[model samples]
Target chain A: MSTIDVNGTAVEVDEEGYLVDLGSWTPEIGTALAKGDDCELTDNHWEVINFLREYYEEYQIAPAVRVLTKAIGKKLGKDKGNSKYLYELFPYGPAKQACKYAGLPKPTGCV
Target chain B: MSDVKKFLYVNRKQPYGTIYALESLEVVLIGAAFEQDVSLAFVDDGVYQLTKGQDPSGIGMKNFSPTYTALGDYDINKIYVEKESLEARGLTIDDLQHLTWEDEDEDWAEKDSIRVVSASEMAEIMDQQDIVLSF
Candidate 1:
């Protein structure tokens, strides 16, 4: 039962600060969520965020870390393909943290 | 609650009828990274999870039973099976895959992975665990 104000409008978020309503998500909401975690979103971070959002829209499920790493590698290049690189971009966990920012449900199963 | 507490995951369901057994195994595998004192207990129909010669291809399911053999590689070598449950189901040790893991402390000597315990012995194990998650 936590909420964060985005552009003077109160929006509901979950315990982990992920937006409760998927329809309520916006660029500002993403920025605010990242700021709450003391993370300033860089272009590289946004790249992953956008990728995850697109991936979810198509698959109806958030990609796990391994899947995300491979997809990123294919689209971005092998230089950014492995989990080690993704972990550096999202320190908490690429599959989890990035999905939260992307406004997707938490990935299930073994991540 | 202290981090890395003794955890006993009790499995009592069949493997594929529902996702419980697979999901529980997933959590156990995930929990291993924490290096906690983890023990897995199989009772009731859950004993079928370790049965050999499983071919789920007829059901269009990819057989994940082989993952049980790899559990030891993940340092999850402690598995307990309820003796009565298997006996009631007409299953014996010969019907189970003989899984073994190398003991790092024993200079990589291979050791049996599963231990058959009586109902009373399993109760003692459950009593000793700090956290018990049954599926």
Candidate 2:
């Protein structure tokens, strides 16, 4: 486990940079974490982060890329629903990186 | 730690019933990061892992089978789907996902990822591996 400073408050993050305790998450922490990954939090990124957080709250797990893409397509417009666009926003992976910024657990099943 | 070795991940269990199939795939993805010679062999009930149009919502499970399509991006595209196993389960190549990858060395030509092989041929492949992890 490692710690990062968010508004001068130290918060623990896992080795993969996901929040150790999801309850410790905040917009400031998400911004700080995205900065560490060389990303800026645009409205597009928040759209994904918010969706992931809501999905995790409902399913108790972050979805893999396929499920995420399908759900995004059904809820958001198809224009913002494809993996290419999601990958463009996260670069690393939509499921992994976006969930990390959303303070969700690293999705375990085949991600 | 970059000592390149041949890794054969033998998957013989059915998907969804147990965690073995999904967990084995997790190892495959991590193994990809090591840049080793990785090949996956689907034998016995494991052939169901790649069956297309799997909807797990009725059982309250998330379908992660599509992750197999991205294996090529990790440079782990050599997959042997045993014909005997599929036949035993009354299936054919058409029942599975059409997985493909681009061959950059060959003018970016699209190539199939799954190769159907006989059980005996798979035995020969298993014999050639340096490290075999069967699930």
Candidate 3:
């Protein structure tokens, strides 16, 4: 059994290393996740975080990078949906970081 | 505002031609900064984004595929590819670089971490998103 202290709260990890109670997550918890992981959330981080939360609600899952690009292009206009713009903002992994900030469970199958 | 929001970025364009692919990446990156939850679905020609070994130098374009590797730094890891799209395009997980396989020696399966679904499944995902941005 592995345990992670999130925002001073001890969270027990299951055998699979997933959170036992995913619902207990919150934005504050996400902030903690970023901090614990040493990721810095910049002004641009908000757009993807908000987008992921809404995306999860509709599909109950996180969108992969390719799909994310196309979707953003359609809604926010084509200019803001390309990979170059996305890399500039997240510079890491938009889906992973955004999911964490959205308080959603870590996306399955990510390394 | 209006509580946390959800967005679905639908990628449908080719890797080059237009700026659609790059623009979509920006929204997801910025959207995450805003604390929004984001997911992505690739359909039609959009599947090309996941293809591997792309050398854009001949066209005088930078190699954009490498940027996909940076998604983890930002924590945006959710990635999906339509199974049918892969088949239709004669693409397999092996054709793509970043994706992992269960067998590591075989084709992508349903159990693969990437959500490879049908057109209808993609549509369902779109309808559920608070905002569906297509490129």
> lDDT for each of the candidates?
0.82, 0.85, 0.67
DockQ of 1: 0.05
lDDT of 1 by residue, B8-98 (tens): 9999998888999888977776666567788889999999999998888888875768767756655677899999999999999889988
Task: Give the CAPRI rating of model 2.
Answer: incorrect
Model 1 misses residue B55 by how many Å? 0.7
User: What TM-score, computed on C-alpha atoms, does each candidate reach?
Assistant: 0.56, 0.64, 0.48
The whole-model C-alpha lDDT of candidate 2 against the native structure comes to 0.85
Ranking by DockQ: 2, 1, 3
Give the candidate order by descending lDDT: 2, 1, 3
Model 3 C-alpha lDDT per residue in residues B1-135, reported as the tens digit of each score? 777667778898888888899778766655665566667788888889878888888999756665555454344545677778888888887887664223313431322335677878777777788888888
| Residue-level lDDT for B15 in candidate 3 | 88
Error of 2 at A71 (Å): 22
TM-score of chain A of 3: 0.71
The sequence of per-residue lDDT tens digits that candidate 2 reaches over residues A27-95 is 899998998898999999999999998877654556667668866876797887899999999999898
DockQ values per model? 0.05, 0.11, 0.03
Regions of model 3 farther than 4 Å from truth: A1-111, B99-113
Relative to the real complex, the DockQ score for model 2 comes to 0.11
Better of 1 and 3 by TM-score: 1
Determine which window of 10 residues in candidate 2 chain B has minimal summed lDDT: B67-76
